[model samples]
Target chain A: MDSPNNDYLIKKINYEIKKRNIKKVPFLEIRNNRLQGVVSSGSDIRRVYVCVIDNNNNTFSCHTNNNRKCGGLDTQYVCSHLSALISQANLRSEEDEKFDTLASTTNKQGDTKARYPEVFARFQHYLKYLQMEATIESIPEMEWFISN
Target chain B: MTAKITLKENDHINNPMIFSNDVKLDQVFEIQHQLIQVFSNGFSKLNSKGIETLKEINIAFSTSPLNTLISEAITGLNNNQLTSSNFDLLAIVMASIDGSAYDSLFDELNKLMENQVSLIDNAKEINYTSNTEDHENFLESIKSWLIDLAIMGFTEINMDVLESFEQVMDTLENIPELMRLNVILRGFIEEITTEIPITSQDEFPAKRWLGLWLRSYLLTMQLPKENVQSIKDCKLKIIGVQKYSHDYFTLYTFHGILDHEGNNRLIQIEAKKFTINEVSNNELLDLLNSTHPELFKGLEENLVIQVKQGMISGNYLILEKFKTTTTSFDIYETLAVLFESKTISYNKQNPYNRHPLLLKYPVLCKIENITKDGTSKFDWGDIPIRFDKVGTLNEKWKLANSKGIFGFIQFDNGWWISPVTILGDKNQYIGYTYSQDRSGKNVYEVLKERSNAILRSKS
Candidate 1:
């Protein structure tokens, strides 16, 4: 896909997500070569199994027994649930970069731990993953994706 | 110590008519003329014995007219038309009337004058002038008039009337003639007090007002030795002292023994022009120990001197000593105070199940479960976040949740809620459903398609 087409697809996904008011990011994880997650069609808590081709492209597919289909799952069309997931992925990458910067700057002084204990606790969790010598390839593309 | 009585504004009077600016001086003079005419009619019927004596004259025919005249005079006096002549005429007429009528009329006039002084003091624009000569002349006239009334057996009237006369004497100190008249007035009071027997129980009609008046009269005469002895003889207990101003202090006392009327009324002695020496608490204690040690015996151990400062424009202090008792409270009592003072409301139907205090101190909660129908359950970990201090928790939660695929719920108790599905749009009020059914279909996507279809159909 061309760069313009990818941008258009991302925009379409975002518009759909906003239109549907899809607030919750569905459970997503990287398994084998596929990016898999559950995404809500709208406000209904019912879930749709979405599988995306992990080629850094906008190719994805969704399946649900309830006859509800996300048109945006196709490369030609985009849905809000797909847009919300994409947006969630982008946000996770930016947050990871910020955490890396904060960690590097606050390496000497652990004073930030006292001021923001919650953030420091999560940072410590990230540090544990780093300590295990886990490379970026070992983790899911979305840094916030927690396996159920 | 020399007693210095600086008169402060009396606050007891609240009369709009007295404070009205439209009152004319001629109107006041007219009322005065009418009062004098009534008094002259009463005086004409008196023969030498009747005029010279305080005996009941057939002035019964003139009582109703005299009362009407006095009422009109009072209205004028209260409206600030009280001239020196009017005061003199009222004093003489009050002395000559029968004791019962005199007592009632004198009381009314006394109240009117008090209200007039109060109104003048309170008015922002003072139009009336203080006539020093007129006031002095009125004092002189009252002294001579009292002497004549005393010789005519009018001294035996109710003590309430004497009390009213004492109040009139209070305003006379500013007059220059008061120096000589004070001596004469002291003699009269001394003679009267001697004749009027002081008793805790008596059949006298004026016993209560007279007993109170005698104590005040002795104090005014600067006879502290006699004053103390008189208080002890009459069995009076000094309760408290209220300092209204630098020069005026009202000493409140109750009778140690009930009067003949079985009334133990609180007697207020208005001591004016009293000078207070510069003394700390210790110095005052030492002085009290030396001069009046018996005064301290009545006080409780835990006496709290509550000095209410800044009551007036200047640096004024009103010190009141009150006995205090220490009471200890347990946990239950502390809870009672909390329940009584702090308003806490609870709603059983609210999703957060929050008390008002909890909403005040909002905490971030992890979304534990989200039903397919959009309702979510949250688990707030150990950390406490004050919702009031954190501006817009919905926005902050949205920003924080952007970094994670896991959903979170942020709400201000019952005020509003940010459901997990529409995390970014915190202001959206999408209905929540807590059903556990997972339809294997994205409800958000389904709703979005339906909304788009509706929009497409409408367009």
Candidate 2:
């Protein structure tokens, strides 16, 4: 079940983190063979983009409000949005959520669009942490969802 | 290095860090929960009980920051309803107080928790220190902190711990005995905090690190000599030979062999130190032998050999003597031995045992496009393995038509196999000048950086 094992994607994300000053990730998830998250833009506090990076297939999609595709598809380039999403995916992975990076991910080479709807929804749910989570007991969905 | 130097038994009582009692602790947790319940009900309905509870908790601890922050959080809400960011900050403060919560007090609640140390003492008697046990206690704290990082991952913790820990390490680094231990941990902090891990190569000396698990285990052993036993001679059909490398030097070679049921498993055994000082793989053949030399002729991956004798130390076998027999397996067959086995990691039937990192496996996978820059994933079973450190091409890749290749799959940030040799006309070994930095730093880098020193010197 090998997906993407932290090589190119992480390196690019690290560069983006420094360049964009992305100190607080707030929300991130690695599921269904790619790294995905809804990240709040540093410049625009109200703006958040649902970004995804599948290192195995070498493709990514950032459903930003614009039509621009991240440099992830271009040679030697990675989108800042996608980079922030993947920067901490491994660092944030919990125990039972153990996912093996799939070597057989070539099947997803052109199938990047299929994962967006679900990823976008997860991003919306993940945003709840920044709001008041008034419950006395810890919420299960907010389990790995950490904030400083 | 299980050399016992009995210190004191009541050290925990002598210098306690967690001083909050059960009753006070219960009150803290109770106050936190009620605060959440009140806040969760929303600020518009800020119940009197919740506000009173905040006042009570703030006053109870005599914690000034807590009192000021609590007031600032709710004070102006009625007048000008704070921004979502302010509400976010308040939520974080409330969540940080989640009961069973003393650990977080160090980071987010920095102004609160006490009991800190800044000592220069170099005493073997840790109990004698007033604030902190500058030697053994510091070592213990580091180990536990590392385990927490491993189990919880770096992102889960607040980044401030890194700065605080660096301060502690800086103060403790001057002690000669703690130098090696500090350097490794310091290397890890330097890498993981600043650079993302993408490969397993670093400036860390693997030659000293491979014995980490063995060292930590033996450190606690009371009957070190009694644990050493000998197996006269046995036939071992080698399953695989795992090599952990730093530069050109092979750090450690994990030899995977067949057990009685013919199941392949990776066993970690050092060439030395079983009892008082520990024995080697073949030392069991001698009643009181000092060293057991390893014979490597017949021990290639997927080869059969007759082991003349070996030592069984804990869960690993140290093969002192062995003869090369004839054997060969195709690529798929070899892959089956490496991955298809029921026990890829330590299990009940494994020759393996508990280890902090994953067992390195010998893997053969096709290379699509070798990472030319720092932005490509090296294909493993067609999946991409991120390789940021690309070494200059030293050997010929054109020799094999660049088809299937051989590499060692060990645990780094994730499971990674760094392709070292391509299956060419003959089995040609390839070389690369992998760039040494944070990305090239293996998760094992810090591992090598840490306890192998303390346990080794103490042993």
Candidate maximizing DockQ: 2
Query: What TM-score does the predicted chain A of each candidate obtain versus native chain A?
Result: 0.38, 0.48
Q: Count residue pairs with overlapping backbones in model 2.
A: 16
Residue B201, candidate 1: C-alpha displacement in angstroms: 49
lDDT by residue for model 1 over B1-459, one digit each (tens)? Answer: 112211112110111122212323333233333332223223323334332232111122133434434444434334434343333334323322212221233234335323211111122222222223345446444644443332223223434445456545545534443332332353344334333432322222222222222222222221101001111112222223221111011111111111112222222222221111111123223333343333333222212222122111001111122222232112123222323443211111111111111111111123333323323333322222222121122333443433211111122212222222222222111111122444334432433443343223321
Candidates in order have lDDT scores of: 0.27, 0.36
Worst 10 residues of 2 chain B by lDDT: B272-281
Clashing residue pair totals per candidate (backbone < 3 A): 32, 16
Q: What TM-score results for chain B in every one of the models?
A: 0.21, 0.35
- What lDDT is reached at residue A61 by model 1? 45
Error of 1 at B82 (Å): 9.4
In model 2, the runs with Cα more than 4 Å from the true position are A1-148, B1-232, B236-250, B259-261, B268-305, B311-316, B321-381, B385-390, B393-403, B406-425, B428-459
RMSD of each: 39.5, 23.2
